[model samples]
Target chain A: MRFKWSNVVLFFGYLFLYFPLICIVIYSFNESRFVSTWTGFSFKWYKALISDPIILRATVTSLKVAGVSATASVILGTMAAIIIARWGAFPGNTLFLGAITAPLVMPEVVMGLSLLMLFVGMESFFGWPSRSGNITVIIAHITLTLSYVTLLVQARLQDLDNSIEEAALDLGASPLKVFFVITLPMIAPAIVLGWLLAFVLSLDDVVIASFVAGPGSTTLPMIVFSSLRFGISPEINALATILMTILSIAVIMSAVFIYKDGNIKNM
Target chain B: MYRIEEIIISWFSELMKKIKGRHFLVAIPYGWVFVFFICPCLILIRISLAENLIASPPYTSLIEWISGYMLQIRINLGNYMVLFTDEMYIRGFATSILIAGTSTICCLLMGFPMAYAIARSSEKIRGILLMLVVLPFWTSFLIRVYAWIMLLSPCGFINNLLIRLNLIEAPLQLMNNSCAACIGIIYAYLPFMIFPLYSAIEKIDYTLMEAAYDLGSSPLKAFFSIVVPLAIPGIYAGSALVFVPAIGEFVIPELLGGAQTLTIGRLVWNEFFGNMSWPTAASLSIILLIFVVFPIVFAQRRREAKLSIVD
Candidate 1:
């Protein structure tokens, strides 16, 4: 390898990105109660993490919210993407576009604050979804990730050749038949990719969940954030390591999926 | 196989005719976004205009039914007034913008070269490198921030290493400051910067650079005149992505920044959760969001319009 400046840059860049994760993984096995200390390797924190009810419940809540939200967001996002890519200029199209993508730029604090207010108002007025809980969090997550999915799917749909769908339509197939049998399958990869992105995002979110969560509805990031205030702990490190490992696997799997599907062919 | 295909096609076509009657499949998402997504911001705006209350919901309703014939709408601009009048709120907004802006610049400085190198790399290497960039993003964001805490605390990796090497007499205050917060933001958002810039730089025709070189332009000169101009849209996109979220970042600043380091995100959070002042928080959020978001959205829209025109 030649001593090129670009190679040097890339080397340091990758190091910066991966070093923290490497440190977390290594330290998760440290027997020391303190996070930063170097102790002999042990599965102590992992064992502790498994037995800790709060962390376990929070992890379950986070996954449940993420699962529900990602699925909902994908459905909504796919619809939004199809509208943007194929519907062209329909009534209220501009507003639809603006509404969908606005959350992409809106800050989390603002979104969280606003959504909390909305929940309060809704509870007072309608008496439905009477309290903020997993339902509200899932709704908020869907709102946050809908734009991302739409953007990804819209890009895929735009890149897609319409000829195949057109061919199906011209062959006496209804528009719905064309979409179900042709367009949806063609963009299935984008939908899967969108779902994964949304899932990761919903799982990672702390701010919005913090605002909207009611009693006994704590999510994993909320737990992590609160614990962080008191300082880092070995147990949290263990939890983080586990979460990171799972997420890394999911990301790698998606990357491989995308690679095989020719999504990364252009990149 | 032929018989099965015929059966499936006939059933699907029959189902398709029923599905075609409801061609507005998009309405499901559109309505959901309108109710759950757009309405919340509108509700925020309404709440921000209402009086703060010492009640369960914590804000006075803007509308009242005074009589059967009339509706009384109380529009209090005092929330906005107080937000502007308070120096703390002003300072919070300014500090948030400054921190976010500085961190965005740092991310760009670090990300651009990496993105350029990746874009210029072989196809095989580029894919792996981009995946590496994206992989860490899937990790818990809070955990990544925590990793920094482990590295920067008094007895943390950096201090311990430095002490062992005899470089420092005392532990440096690397954590719990705006600098740490900036580092966190830059680290967290670097991939955001890199990905967009990579796509933008990747799209540039290498022949443009080659043409510039053949015309006797220096490499740096050619890069400035050719590459930079071409990547402006990506720069804008990446900057907006980094800056907007960084400004409203709560977890990074709260965990990394100590008592003195105050950003709008922390301020809003404290006001709502600590002070139980919902209206003030809502107003603060509304103001911060409008001032920053409008310009970026407009710029993006204009760029989209221009691109559509070209197409």
Candidate 2:
């Protein structure tokens, strides 16, 4: 009885998690203009979503920001992870650690508001970045995503065997060379995972982007959010389905890659 | 390609040689974080103290040089004061805490059994089950929240299905309420609660439970005495994870909740955008930050203490 009861709870939990998402996908194909009622099946909403210029532009912008911010954050976060995990301690290390971890728990509204204020202050003081635009959004995203990447990479680094890098250094390779040839390759998977995480975070962000986005710099989430404000739309459902499909494909591919990599390592 | 790669490597090596590699590695990210993350927080506090102005940037300077020598400081305590006196702000805080707290408990109740089941499953099934839990989290958060809207809205799938079944004459008032907001929070954050609990529970040796059974302890008693005590760390971690974010959640309450559900996050957003009051928003954010920081610090300290005890 206990076994059966636990299974029932697990089943219902999975149902609750996936049911709404499945409903959206099913409704996306519904032919009726009204979202609740189903008349027939159609792909018209998907076609409409494809033709929407605003959404397309926003998608392009989101991709740009996500791509740039993810790459930038990977570099910065890797540095941070190396410093925290490899380097024993340094002056202001506690402060640096605080700065790195602050963004993880800081409320989006707080981060967004403060960053916007800083940009405005900078603009007035330096006359540079005259307006909050894609650049500001990218900066905010890097800050927000950096914590995630750093934590991931730092955890990976801490798990690593120290002797590999030590052996490389003992063999007369410079520290820089050892890091590039040994440590970098070893942590490459974590870095890739971090980059993907950062990318998704930037892509999914709406609250921070809403604050920092300037005129003509609306992101995909921003656009979708604004449309959602009016009520349910079939196009939004179609868009949700597409986004879910892409994410699932990415996740499955990565999972397969990791599984294969693990098998190869075992061999 | 080989020649270009060699050239790039040499160039990078020379650059690294010029700047001490250790400092170079540490300085870049540290400086970026200091400038972007740390400075902005200080800027937030400063902005929160400034009076609202009708200009671009929209706040009066807190410090000014008067008559080339004397410095005048105008620190407005009004913004923070307003948060205390204003009934709307007070209610917003209370409502946010109530909703977040309620959702965290609900998630714990739902997630504990699911996590325990996964931990007890066969190895292969465990991996697949864990993946299923994490898969939804990879999708867009906005889309996930938007999913609830599709289900709970008056003209949504749930309502449509109920009406079609002739179970009710009118569609239930499911959406645009605090209940819907709580459901959205629990739904979105359930995985957060489950992951930590699964890890903690997975670490428990099944032999211990079997021993408890051999000793004739009831299943309920064994679970309460053994499993619950062991899972306290995960419970704390998961609750902190859910409760903190849920407190500041903007989209869930804004979309699913009605006007009565004026969460601190939504209030801050409206103060900034709808009312164009930056200082008020900044102050509210500062207050919200205070509320969030306590739990995080407490959790960190408790985890540290637990680790020391384990050691």
Candidate 3:
């Protein structure tokens, strides 16, 4: 029995999911500052957003944070994946896996506080790196995103056949050469996808950054959050529209890369 | 199956073959977590016993630390005890669980129909419906959540439309409240609930439903008897996935809870920043971790144990 209610119910569900965003997007173009009422449509808020120093600064800061944190996370995550995949369940393997992935499920408050505490310890112990701002933000971002990178890369690596590495070894290639030439090339798509994921996660994080970020390290989310102090602004819609474009591109890119990678071997 | 002796011998050889360069290359990942994730959390577990929140770090020793800063780390269970004694904190945790549980239930109720709809749709329509389910995630989560402030506010669309229809006399108090916050959480997290259930529902052979119909079962009975049982795993899977994070949800509550309600998430946030209670906050963090992780580990292990018996 093809339940005809399925299609009708689904239309309402789809509408529910998108109605709010559509309203906000539409009202962003409204001449009135108030989001509720839609007066005549105008491009004023969008124009004002272009000249807003604070919004621009926040966008720049968020980009930098996402860039730096995503980069570091990629390196750390790739390293973790290679190690875990190459070394079959070592002594600390189980514990290490748990620890790395634990950050994923850990409450943001828990992660934020603990990471801040860690930085405090680092400062006191090392007697340097005193300030907690961009560096700490990047570090914390890496700590959080590392798990995603590792999880993704590990998953991709699991599907790869071991015979390629075995063949390289059988040719009298050293471990370094084998990995650099064979494994690295093979897992390239995963690394790229992992980087993209890490970037997005770093961009999305709010709470952890709140704890670790010091003065002037306000990322985009931090800026949006602070902007809420004065209540909602339509310019927020302009900024949101831009960021949504960037994220959409990033997601589409990841999907393409993953799809290609999956089909690459078959082709 | 291969002979046990041969399998063990080959396993050792294969392991050795794979073990070539033992460089620090492999240590990087584990090492990072060991220091950042494990060490800091363990340090929190040590620091949680402080007498007060503001006793700045370098608590000297573990034993004294627990008892509060008494020239050193003196052991004290006061914080945990206070967590119990303090009505606000106890209430906060309870409320956090309540909000997360209620919203999770709501998510299931809303998500099941949508997921089933998507699963039951024509193959082509299913892809589009599924894409719609996932599309929200492509946008900024915060922005989507912020949309609610506009939707649920006094003059927000929901209230405005309802009033225009003469459904209510005045706008309901919708924004910056618990109910609104739950709505945001459910909406922000609906995609998460839908996909897992979708995958689970998609796995159930349609023939099962067809078989039930052929047996003269009503559609309702077919759902209850055949569909529901097959979907229980998905239900549990999606519920756990959604509920676990909802418990720790911060931004929605912060933006939406206004000042009246305090969740465990906001409580922990204030403990670190607002109250300047680093030790207490750290302790609270450890406690929260313990509470969530302990049950999860036990449940996961029990699942595996039961699965092993089936083999």
Give me the candidate number with maximum TM-score. Answer: 2
Which lDDT value does model 2 have at A208? 97
Error of 2 at A179 (Å): 2.1
lDDT of 2 by residue, A1-267 (tens): 877887898899999999989988998999987865678999999999999999999999999999999999999999899999999799999999988998888999999999988888888899766554699899999999999999988988898898999998888999879988999987887888889889999999999999988987899999999988877899999999999999999887777776666721211
Candidate 3 per-residue lDDT, tens place, B1-311, comes to 46998999999999878875564666666677887888888777776865563355634345433346554536777778878889988888887888888899999999999998888778866655676677677787788887888787786778888988999998998877788778988998888889888888988897988898898999899998987777876777687777777888888888887876688888888877777776667667766776667546754765576568759
State the lDDT of candidate 3 residue by residue for A127-240, as single tens digits. Answer: 644554588888788989889888877777888898989998999999879878988887788788778878877888888888888887878888888776456778887777
Model 2 lDDT tens row, B181-260: 99999998999999999989999887888899999999999999899999999999999999999999999999999878
TM-score of chain B of each: 0.87, 0.92, 0.84
By lDDT, rank the candidates, best first. 2, 1, 3
Is candidate 1 or 3 superior in TM-score? 1
Q: Is candidate 1 or candidate 3 better by DockQ?
A: 1
Tell me how candidate 1 scores on lDDT.
0.86
Query: Which runs in model 1 stand beyond 4 Å of their true positions?
Result: A1-3, B1-20, B65-71, B207-218, B301-311
lDDT per model vs. reference: 0.86, 0.91, 0.79
Error of 2 at A164 (Å): 1.4
Worst 10 residues of 3 chain B by lDDT: B58-67
Which regions of candidate 2 fall more than 4 Å away from where they truly are?
A263-267, B1-19
Candidate 1 local Cα displacement, residue A216, angstroms: 2.3
The clash tally of candidate 1 reads 0
